[model samples]
Target chain A: MDSITHAPSTEVLRAIVEAAADGVVLCDADGAVVLVNGAAREMVPGDVTSLLDRGREPGETYETTLGDRRLRVRREIFGIVHQAWYLRDVTQESARADALRAERERTQFLVEAGRRLSASLNTRRCARATAELATGLLADAAMVVLPPGGLRRTAWLRSSEAGLEEGEIPVAHADQVPGLAEALAGFPPVPSRWLDPHQAPEWLLPAGFGPVGHLLVTPLPGNGVPAGALVLARREGGAGFDDETETLVRVFAARAGAAISAAVLYQEQSATNTILAGDLRPPPLPVVDGLELAGSLRAAQQTALIGGDFYDVLPTPDGPLVTLGDVCGKGPRAAVLAGQVRHSLRALLLLERDPEQLMHLINKALLSSYTPRSHVTLVLAAIRPGDGVIDLAVAGHPAPLLLRADGVVEEVDARGTLLGAIRSGAITLRTASVDLAPGDLLLLYSDGITEAFGGPTGREMYGSVRLMTALATCAGMPATAVVERLEQLNSDWLAGGVFDDRALLAIRRSR
Target chain B: MDTAPFLIEIENPEPGTTRLTLSGDFDYTTSADLATMTPTLMSRGLSVLEVDLTGVTFIDSSGLATLIHLYDAAEEHPAEMRFVGMTPYIVHLFEVTALDQVFNLPTSAA
Candidate 1:
């Protein structure tokens, strides 16, 4: 007999079946377990071959219990009077389906919470909504910890499905809020999941929520800083908190903090405006050249002082240097321009001998720096001692009033367009001879004085005729008295304050 | 005219013709709010309308516009409009625009 060299086909087949990840079993006719692989043998406990003689009929379905698992046996008729059976173990697939379902449920819950948060407008309403949603959707109890004297506390607490309940939780000072303190102190947003209730610092847990079974604490970061902490607690029976809840709470808290800060700033500006309007008087002005001069000193949109209308009298070696001018507009910005003009004149006067030269320098200085919105109308005059003659220069300003000793009034006809009004334009100074004999006057006044009205008919202006007549009548009075009378006349002429602030300059040749 | 010129004079009052002279400098700031006398002056029944510029040494564009408005209104009566006491500069402004022909301009004291 040839030594039977039997190939190990059966062993190879057994190895293939045992290597399969799924449990495999082979049964014969009558639905009895005829063969079982390693996986199947290990999965089933009790007797190893007892299933082979079971009284199961051919082509019958049977439920068999093996160890802790349940198996399904199905028999089928093979060729003529032969039967085969297939067995399957379906535990892991069922577990995978359950996990997917739970994951979907958690995502839906987070989406619903986000929608509710967006519906809230103001910070207070948003906070309440956020607290309720967090507690209700996430755990047994939740609290949005606010900054309390630079700490965190459950001042407002909410329970699952219920609104705020009456209770106060001890605050966790900023130094004691566990991971939160670190976040607020300068760490980026942190999400912490605590498996053991007591693992986190005792101060971090709210007073009422004892021994957090599962706590998800996340930092509320705003404008690159941690504003506060959101604490969600889960009791033993509630769903465990996850990353989704942490992210949602974090986003809502950041937006709420920013909105609250902006509202506070708006309130402050409103209060500022009220105070500013109440105390809007003109700024104080300095006396120029023995003239009690006041122009529009109130500030406007651009500069702090109204610049156009200017008046100043500085004492020089020659005599008192008198400059009365306007930079064009009224109000504070014009006043600032007026101040600039005055400053330029002061600087130029030291170097230039002629009034025209001084004005030319001013023009050149303004041309380099003037904005399109600004222009100046100026009249510069220099008076010398022992001479009644005044070197006069005009740049688009009103003529000065020259009062003669015999009560004859002459309007200085010095003609020049306003300085800085025409670029590169020459400043003309016409030498006008006037005898400032005793009792004679030189009055330089702004337009505000002439437009004033005294009577019920406010239409008629306080014309120059009245000014000349008043000047003629008041010529004999002292210089101080003359100015007072003129101011009084101006006040009486207008119903109220000078139609505009009157900048009046009076110079009488003293005997 | 049966009644005094539709005019209310506080400083100086004339007869049938009421004159309201605006003197010194005129500009947008003062011109913004019209005085109540503007309407009252127009309401008066007078044949001669006189705005004495004699006392007015300076006038800005705003003042010139006001005078033009008054002149147009007074044109309804031929002999009613007269601008007197114009400074040389003011006259020059009116003469350049030929507005002197539209209203009676008082000659210089010369």
Candidate 2:
């Protein structure tokens, strides 16, 4: 195909070749530089044609010098007879491909760090993930420092190193480097590297920190606020961290801080919940002989150990009046209302001299002051000293069990609506007049004691029958002994699991 | 629990009344049971279906999705559906999803 082209066509081909950005060249099969385009000539100048004729294979790359510059040359077969050769310059393309590859690797590292950061919510897990994420993204060992209760001086290190326990680092030791310590004391995600371990103060070196390495410490903020530092280390000879690595570590640290903060909040809330639950449990009251006395006084929900059940031996004109009641519900609301009912009942009982009138006046005040939504059930009994008469009244509560000296268990069924259940409603407080013969005993309690489900069948509740049976056993026991026995039985029935707030009151007629 | 193919029944007696009577737990494990039952009910073309949930004691999101899917499917037929006989806890799930307003919920005291 040896067709001779026109002079204009040859000139057009030369112009097109010169206009191309790539370096173009022509050589003979024997590796002689036959012709070179303007780009190729500019890339490799000084008539280096003698070097190209050294019989190199086609498509083989070779290095050449053009003036003061270095260029890479590749030869390839072109014509049908393979007599002509093509030379191309590929230095710039090679550099661009390398940059693209690096960028892809950095992107992949960031994506993996993000995936690890989202895997766990535990504080320890979060700290470990943060360290691993940092190390994976950069050529460094990562460490996390958290101050106890957000205190800057109290250091807690959660680092990537094995066998490193938190709270081992003293801030005084960490602050040996005033510069590093000061930067951490302020807001974190602090971007700085401390390369010299000797420059790092003796105090700043964590307990047992060994070896020499390049250090990169960044400020980290927990969900509450920026409160810690993420320190990365690259052992000598390891690649120094770049901006891409720093950015990736910082991003992962921020997410890790948020997760740790959430776990801390969950722990705090759990503690608060425990306290709230504790308030519902009735306190261990005085127990002696075979009888026991149970009562509670509530202040408010947040206040520890405040409740409504109360018992005290107060001097009346005759003897002592035993009182017990349950404000519906638990926590602060019950506590507040319990205080009102307790004081009103106490003050009225002392002044009015009549238990019925006292309860009526208390109900009137409760109806006027309290909304219909709130209510409480109460039981009041007046015992005469040296006298056998026991007067009792009930307001929507369990009937007190009477343990007679003759071993007969009598259930004093008294009826009344729960206080506050009705607004301005009158309670016909009937006095159950019972003759407390020698060795007679009475037990009063809140519904929680009876309704509590315990024993072999955890689901089956300990109803009034069980309480009466337990009371019968305390026939001749002292008032204190009676309550102690009941508590033991209740505890046994619970099988070591107490669920509800229980309040029990026991009164005995002194022989 | 075979964990295989199952049937779901959607019955409507009159216009403006739709009933999706379910017979199984509606959770992740039984999601496909409702998936198979959805298209057959859509063919009848009713405007309102009252879901008889009395037979269903427990239901999860898979079951929840059946209702949601039915609700969505009813929209295409231009029908308003209601849920009935739901346990108090399951009704709470509906309230949480904000589906109580979208679907007619039985309002009897617990």
Candidate 3:
């Protein structure tokens, strides 16, 4: 080998090593200190031989720190007596790497959080999911607060040692629900300091709740105003919810807020619609000389008071005309259709006395009207006051259940083509006459009662069998009590909730 | 219960037929979205408008109403509007409401 290339002079090597920015060291095979460069001298202040022991090896690279400096150290045995070390001060690089890793983790977390938040449209489930996703990751605990009447509600959830548990947290006053008033005030991410856990509001600590040290109350603004708020609590040792983390939490809350807002609007509209749909309601139950009439109608979702289900009682020249119908859908549109059908039936009652003929006229009107055609199932009963006789006409509606004073439960055999299923002039219907004795009760209801999908198995339909069985239990009951019993049974059948509006009209004969 | 979100996809199958695909539950809140899209397609001057209900999972009174209104609009525009890719449930729904005689709907049960 050429002398200069193969083995430069010690002085030239020293000059080269000193000129390099990275720390360089040379040692003997025994790992004893032989020589050190300027950078090495600065990085390795003392005990250069011991540093050689850590660095001297062939094809080996590792990381270590020397005083305040982080170093990427590499070693190679240049010859039998010479071992060379290369040390790079990697402090800034390691910091950048750590920051990049942290950023990726945060991005991944936020994406997952956003996906989870928007996955469900159900307000309760979405609210609960918002709390779970924020807990043990974003904070120690999280709570979803529905600002009720801008004040109070019946149920709440709390994070405990056994995981998040649900219960009713009764708040006596509006101010007791911490962070609600403030959140609604538009001051979002309201950082609250809790110097003592005992001092926290009682509602915040039901029976056994958080040992929280701090809280960040963030308002979930739905359509500009705050519909609800998410309360994130950090147990002791947290430095409160910082602005950066608070921003992410607030964003999550905002997405949750939008869903809450939709539900809130739907509920509010349904309430107003119940009052507005009053025009579509059946005329007040006329005081029959020898009978009692009663009915109840409510939205299935519990969020709305009135929907597609409606009941009407009209006093005609001949007798008392009773109608209960369920339009094909719910909400304002269905309510409108229900109103139209009821009002039209009342108007048609004057022109035609036969229940079957009236149904034909109504069906024709529905098909020919410029308004969108909606399928409706109705049971029209023309009960002769003081005569104990009812003429029932069915149109794709559930059969009426009759409870006899003799304790026999029977279903009316009346059946007809569903209105709107056939052309207006082509509808086929039949009227059945039933003779009722004193203390007998007849129940007219929507399919929502018989089709309520639940039970012990949760998959079994509340078929006509169960409905008849349930009605048997209400034998000899008053008209109002009979309807209430059926409503209670329907509610009980649905373990969790209902998916259809229910309407029931009951008539009882009294001697 | 949460109402499913509505999806509206407008695809031109051929030169003159505009196919609008609807999916998710069509109820009071969401049927309006589909209704709002009909006039735009009607005014676009298509020869034949086909509503693809293959993706639609459920429809209610308002949804049917929206369809009826669309049919009415199609008639005034002189566009031959039709329905295709209907599920059996939808076919049954039309049959039950007697709307089968009014609007051209798919008959085969799916």
* lDDT ranking from best candidate downward: 3, 2, 1
What's the CA error at residue B23 for candidate 2, in Å? 20
**Ordered list by TM-score, greatest first:** 2, 3, 1
lDDT of each: 0.56, 0.60, 0.73
Show what share of the native A-B interface contacts model 2 retains.
0.00
Q: Kindly report which residue stretches of model 2 are placed more than 4 angstroms away from their true locations once superposed.
A: A1-319, A335-354, A357-372, A454-458, A488-498, B1-110
* CA deviation > 4 Å runs, candidate 3: A1-6, A28-32, A41-58, A65-69, A148-162, A167-181, A190-215, A233-243, A263-511, B1-110
What is candidate 2's lDDT per residue for A260-292, written digit by digit as tens?
677666667656655544444444543332223
Q: Can you give the lDDT of residue A346 in candidate 2?
A: 63
In Å, residue A67's CA in model 1 sits off its true spot by: 57
Stronger candidate by lDDT (1 vs 3)? 3
- Model 2 earns a TM-score of 0.47
Which has the higher TM-score value, candidate number 1 or candidate number 2?
2
lDDT of 2: 0.60
User: If you score just chain A, what TM-score does every candidate get?
Assistant: 0.44, 0.53, 0.52
Estimate, for each residue in A115-220, the C-alpha lDDT of model 3 and write its tens digit: 8766765667767777777777677767777656534454555553447766554434435556655775556555455223334565664355446677677787
